[model samples]
Target: MSGYLALLGSSFEFFCLVILDLERFALAGQPHWDELEATLQRLENDPDRGFHDLAAAQRFHYLYQRAASDLGRLASFSAETSLRRRLEGLVARAYAELHSAREARDTRWRPLVWLLETFPRTFRRHAGAWWLAVAVTLLGSVVGAFLVAADPEAKASLLPFGHGEMNPSERVAKEEAGRSKGLANRRSSFAAELMANNIRVSLKAVAFGLTWGIGTLAILFYNGVILGGVMLDYLRAGEGLFLAGWILPHGSTEIPAIVLGGQAGLMLARGVIGWGARVPLGRRLRAIAPDVATIIGGLALLLVWAGIVESFLSQYHEPVLPYWLKITFGVANLAILGAWLFLCGRGPTPED
Candidate 1:
């Protein structure tokens, strides 16, 4: 009789365990069912929305994964046919939606779309930092230029490669000869070298932010001084027009890229400094990662375009194209870039 009683007690406990498992499964799936249904409804109502919106897409993905996990759990333990069926259907729908979105993003034009829509929007969010970088560089250039203009002796310290040692006429002659040789004889090699050097400089500026942005600032200041000194020397030599023609075409793009790189570095530095300390240092750095990537990507594209222009159109074409024409080309390029940055991807404002 005791043995019979023990078997009965064990069976009862097993039944209770099964009942508890069923309850847990139902509770787990209930919330996910409601959310999945709502999200599906929203997606169906607005087919054009959600997929491109990063937040919405992430939410949908999260909900989908939850629903899928619930489906698996219910299939394994739940005897309720209706509950399992409902969850299975929801999972199927979500899988389809996610797959479709993924396919759409796989299109070739998706990268261009990202560049046009995402890059600028991200950059605009950090416009203050970018503008600060531009201001610092411009101020440095002005100070350097003024110093060179005020004191001839300052040229030796500011100018690279002892350019200060050359007399005005000698400097002018050397500049003209270098330009002629590069353009007339070694245009391809010159362009390649210039592009490589410019890219290296921009990358250095961005990487130097690891030093808390001091390295970045120093690079900008040093380059600014070199530019100012060279400009002054050319102007004094009465070759101002020549300088303008030679520099503007590539400088318009190259300089802006460098500034953008500096801006990225500053953004990184801000993350490192933890100005408010509201978030942990690691979190702050992670937050700025996307912005840094966008800025660097944009800078790289600009550099490639600048390199092409510098090599093919800016350097050797001076003999074929008048200086005014080259200047006009530079202006046109700048205008297009400005419009793209400021205006492109900004659709019509919704009616308030």
Candidate 2:
């Protein structure tokens, strides 16, 4: 009986040593796993551009295969259950990333095809989030319009650059003159500036979502207030028609892009806030990252188009182009955008 007891004690000690050795091996591989994950994340975020990094791709492949082998060894040897589970998850993720990257590489125009097809489908799938963002912005705009209309002094606090001091007529006159002198004279520079500004605003809207979405909402609301106040001021100055023509030309595309940016922020907020608690927060964030990139890319393209219209077509008032024609063109452009987004990619295809 004493010999049997000694034997049991020795076996327990040996088991402990095995655990320690296994732990050491796991720890040794952790940094490589982390580096592989980071590279995978970068590739996932911008798959089209990321595939160009051949070194990173090779590194990921090496680490992934190594991880798979480790996982197999751990499973076969009956390693600690916890460590085995972790390795399993790591191997699964690496496999998915490797598969996706390989598939993307197989299709040279996959990015463009995704933009044309998969992107719209993805956007439509999240239409509820987008519309919610639009509703918030519109509600803010209405509140702003009512406030400025009810209390003329409110404009002082709302409008930027002391523009509130100038009555509606002065504001309209200045805008008209600026458009004529700046946009008409230096179209290229003006377009570039406008595009840059819009891009900045859109980026801010998306970035601020990291703060649990409050920052994004605040930005959208403040911009809405400024727009509403400006519009009311113009209408009060009896330049309603002028304001419509001035804004609609570019506003058609620009407004939707801004709203989409807000939507992206809201999605980020959803992940950070862990809305459903069904999935792990980290997984939720990973799932949404690609969608956020797609939305931002679409917004950038839309802003470019808007900048062009604002710089060229919108500036041509009176004899150069009638207000009626501008409004018609704006409506037509919006219709085209609507059709492209909702109907263009409905055919039977994997991307669609």
Candidate 3:
């Protein structure tokens, strides 16, 4: 009986010792775990840095082994289940890093090549979609102009954003007489707002392709109608030169940007339709995926430039900046943009 009682006491003592040991080990290893986490984070954050430091590699390996050992020791105890799980995760991550045998290909970003070559080439490849967008817009414009010209009352319904309320000639006179100063202190804010509004419109044009391009067509047509109505209004008011100087400076870029967005939408629609293509839906989409991204990139660049031009140059009417000068700038800008899109990427590159 005494031997049995002594054995029970010794078992209780062993239990107490295990609990104490668990507490001590957990406390001691926390710092190592933290160090390992920090090291892993550094490696993950900078792929370019790579595993160049031998000391770090050795320390990482050692920490992983220690965590694994701790995990094994904790297996018999249920009280430290959470710690065991954490250690397991850390050990697994470390193992992956240590055992990775494949050398990853280094890919660096080259913005210039993408901008100068890729963007325009993708645009040219999808020119059919752009032309279709242009045709739909032109049709709408013609319809809008005819409606407004036949019935002056139609301007109120067709023209939006209070444009129909203002007489174009009066507005031009006010702008030339220094109402243009309204944007002086607020040019940057105005520019930012313009960019946001135009970019949002462009993105919607791209997103609407999900409707098999009906939505995209509607957006393009509506924009064109609005543009045509406004142009006709200014011309009727005998403010044609002012209209040209005002709209052309930014419209040269902004209009094309919207059209390109429609182009992207049409491309997405084509991928969805897979009309003549026998490939699977996934493959068709995959083929045009890069092209869609390329078009979006171009649209963004064009809109940003347009926003700057509208805010900085377009608003400065005749007195602040000559009408003739603005007209010339607009013409030159359009010509240069046309050449960049159509001619720049046509032939073989010097590298070829």
Candidate 4:
């Protein structure tokens, strides 16, 4: 029971983290050499929340300095130069900073590593709250679906939250409905395009976690409800079982990762809100960062699985196995998620 609580808490935490960071990352396109360094300095100077570890703080500072210097060289490139030359240098600096940070974990901040290793162990730590979060999300979804089902006009409105300048669903629908030869091949031929679309959708969902996690519990609640409604709609249309068959294989990997990404956003939110809680900000954030990264990294892997599912598994027009087999696989998937949460490692400190 304790382990289950911990997993629930961790899931909530990851969900919050992704929601908070996504918008920021998109608008700014990730921290450049100078920006990341500035963020570190800013974090140190924060009155409510500052770095408790000097070595970790200094290491980030050093990385920023190197990044800054590299950016300086890149800035000198002429406008006529292609992007490959400019991006290569920037990419190298980012990787270097990331690697150095990882190396410092072993030498300067072993506790940070221990904390990360121990995180999955706490799967049962906040069992009550974890269950509550899921319940709240589930209830919200049920209500949202009820509202949509109650009104045919509102159904279209519930399609999705459009990012960027246009609606992706609308664009895709148009492309698929067109009569062009290009569309013909996409419909009847290769799987690459389908894989690409799946990847895009999964990434968008993961990215949205940043907003859902950081904005507020309301944001997370809304996303949960939206997802529920979408799935519920298919189920009502007698496609529920078929949709489940298509989604389960990849969704096993995809959905949890998105939820985890949301946890990351929550981490950022906790940092910002301070929750009026007694804990120091630095420690709280440090605990949150790695977990956030873990989920984000997990999301990337899930996208790959999603591609496979979309390209091949979902393409299966007929059910290939018995109903029991599908149920077994589905249960197995949930069990694996459960095990990952509880059995991985013990938490470093009992309290967050």
Candidate that scores best on TM-score: 3
Please report, as a residue range, the 10-residue window in candidate 3 with the lowest summed lDDT.
100-109
Error in Å for residue 8 of model 4: 65
Q: How much lDDT does each candidate structure score?
A: 0.77, 0.80, 0.85, 0.52
Cα RMSD to the true fold for all candidates: 10.0, 9.3, 9.7, 19.8
Candidate 4, residue 352: how far the Cα is off, in Å: 17
Candidate 1 RMSD to the correct structure: 10.0
| Candidate 1: count of backbone clashes, pairs at least 3 residues apart or interchain | 0
TM-score of 2: 0.70
Give one digit per residue, the lDDT tens place, for model 2 in 195-231.
9998999889999889999998988888788888888
Error of 2 at 288 (Å): 0.9
Which regions of candidate 1 fall more than 4 Å away from where they truly are?
1-109, 161-180, 183-185, 348-352
Q: Which stretches of candidate 4 lie above 4 Å from their native place?
A: 1-119, 122-136, 161-219, 276-287, 319-327, 346-352
TM-score of 3: 0.70
TM, every model: 0.66, 0.70, 0.70, 0.49
- List model 4 lDDT by residue over 1-352, tens digit each: 9999999985675455345543432233234544554554464354234346888657666665545444444454455154334445555644554555543433333445443454454324434324544655577688777866787456567656332223334433343345223333353334555445544543454344345333434544666667666766666656655556555765665555545444545555555456666788776666656555554454455556555554544434333444345545656776876676666555345335
True lDDT of residue 104, candidate 3: 36
Per-residue C-alpha lDDT of model 1 across residues 213-314, encoded as one tens digit per residue: 898888777777777777877787787776777778888898888888888888888898888779998999888987898889888889988988898877
